[model samples]
Target: MSQKKTVYIGPFIQCKTLTDLDICPNGMIGVDEGGRIAFVLRDERGRKIPEGDGWEDAKIVRIQDHGFFFPGFIDTHIHAPQYPNAGIFGKSTLLDWLNTYTFPLESSFADLATASRIYNRVVARTLSHGTTTACYYATVHVPATNLLADICQTRGQRAFVGRVCMHEMSPEYYRDESVETALRDSKACIEHVRKIDPEFDLVTPIITPRFALSCNTESLAALGKLHRELDLPAQTHISENPRECDLVRDLFPESKSYADVYESAGLLTPKMILAHAIHLTEEETALIRARDAKISHCPASNTALTSGRAKVRKMLNAGLNLGLGTDVSGGYTSSILAEAREAVFVSRHVAMDEGDEAKLSVEEALYLATRGGAKVVGLEDRIGGFEVGKMWDAQMIGLEAVGPETTELDQSAGPVEVFGKETWDDLVAKWVYTGDDRSTTAVWVGGRLVHAKEGFRL
Candidate 1:
């Protein structure tokens, strides 16, 4: 396939701000040969195409009335190795779930063949669901973790692949031997990703400490220091469950609080991505905002594991950067759309306890999936939404129509039903409430057709 300059004309929808969505019913976006948006033409009734040097030969793709262009999803935190174990957590919370399900499955990556099989499926599945960029947690095995980076590069999904680091408090068979060995293996994986994608354009390495309970003081400090030395993004869990919080308190008695454990180790930097801040104190929230660190709200995982609902409305009001995460296995679903739905539900639950101001609207949840996620992964300038100079990471969503005459073939489009009398807002609301991966007819990353449904072609 030729990576030529192309023009996409269609009804496009994207979050213009945290509370508002920019729905361009008729728009055109020009993508250059390098896959960046070169020009954008907003709603202009029957306007003629402007002829210029490169615009003269641009291929044009027009979206049908039933479809619209949307920014691809970004999963800020997910365990790629635990994909197979998704939905298997039975009546277990964070700590017990790790021992019963997570550890045993992650330890199986010692076999290179097994790692390749699982990693391949994970990348393909996420892309199929329109996850253009993902922050992945690979197992501690260096070779397996490196294999994940290689697979993402080959498959053309933008990703941050991290080799998990845990030098203490983990199962004896799966844990890293020592602080030196953990650092060495982590460096090896980082170097491997750098070699494969030298500029770190598509795939980058992230420092992952697992969590406070998984690592000792020495390992946490060493990883934090390495994070600064390499200037890489870091991700870890914090304040997910009451038991996990109690364990961190017991483990780091010298620290004032759970957040202080990471703060004292120098891990609370702007590039840090702390997942599941469900039980953060006012002091911790202030500290996180001061450091400019981001949060990944894994709503589905939290509910499934019986973790407390994160005060998302509070976090947004505090000027904290936040995004959605699947937290697979614990989350039970890899779809960010599902996470967006869960986010809305979780916010409603918060509202029931703390009043109406705590509720999150659909616009806010979708924002967390795209723009917010881009910021969390440190790629805000590159892949969030449709704008000149941004990469063309987008999905084509098609909804089924239910009118006087409806065919079975039309119903195959998905669960969302449009009845011609609906406005653009109604259509989008229907999508949010009832849509699934089946509604995603086509997906693109960097102007490349990464996934397409059977009847859809670009």
Candidate 2:
């Protein structure tokens, strides 16, 4: 978190649009003391400073030939309390999975010591994987939920923290006691975040109803009213499982559909982020579009939890805003790079059943990972790309080049091998398919150095 001016020079790549990547082979970008990008110059030679305004001693970060700087990732849906259970779903689906593995694990967060240890580790891990922004769901406990916001603030990660509310049908030991208690606890968490980051420049509070099945009409309506009154963004699950949809129908017989449940409660709005819209109907999609709500396509979790594939191409064709979510624990990973690649495979599966037109290219998936994710979290104007005024929320990605003298392969750069034959697009595709956190040498959020691998220096 240096207050002095800094300049990053060398290859820079970012998604300028959904279908285009802005690849500047040699570029120079300046960041002022307050962390906003001051100027951008393309094809600059030899780390030359912009004609001076007293920046002779500015810090310089130069990237290697095989590396490029890309925008940091955004995870729109993930459970902060379930990070330990990643890759442990076994043979369970939604409801049974919640009862058997999810609830009991989440209930343990009532302990502050347990909450602090896990929150710190998960935040560090995600930042290591180049995730600068995330929308996190915390348990019903107020103290632990507030602790998560504090951790994100301290770690310099941009986050939307929400205290989950499920006043009915959830287990007695874990559910919120009543609607009043649910709203009261949620307000306390919001106030706690405001106290820490008063302007919400780094962290903000989000409304969480924990999906329709876990909440009754009274609690949902009350939470919805709170959302409107506070003018805060919200995140929740939707149509992730067939059994869950059936349960929603039985529980609220008056509602027309799963989307109707939220609409009736006033929870569906432009600020709402719906995760895993895998089984959404045409009408339901239309209603969501009409409301201008956002969608977080968690492909890794959908396939792991046995949820059906989401029709992402259709959503885009219908002019919907969509992004990627790790949905960790259910997703079995914290890396959004893995999530972006999984989205490619999920789109291929979708194309197999529907048509080839449903397929998503590597460029499209990366856009969902960066630009679309920024849109989902309501920070498109501030982050997600390189521009004159946007903050520097980005990661430096390095790929190992194979030379003739190589005897043993380097394990630090992961499995992606660049042999000097790849086009710019091919190189990007290789990383998307096989790259891991090893390729992320350094990460920054709002010009603050948050995480870096061993031996990496500016």
Q: Relative to the unseen true structure, what is the C-alpha lDDT of residue 165 in candidate 1, on a scale of 0 to 100?
A: 93
lDDT of 2: 0.92
Report the C-alpha lDDT of model 2 over 75-157, residue by residue, as the tens digit.
Answer: 99999999999999999997888989899999999999999999999999999999999999999999999999999999999
Q: Which residue runs of candidate 2 sit more than 4 Å off their true CA positions? A: none
Error of 2 at 180 (Å): 0.3
Evaluate all candidate structures by whole-model CA lDDT and list the values in order: 0.92, 0.92
Cα TM-score of candidate 1: 0.98
Relative to the true structure, candidate 2 reaches a TM of 0.98
Residue-pair clashes, model 2: 0
Tell me the TM-score of each prediction against the true structure. Answer: 0.98, 0.98
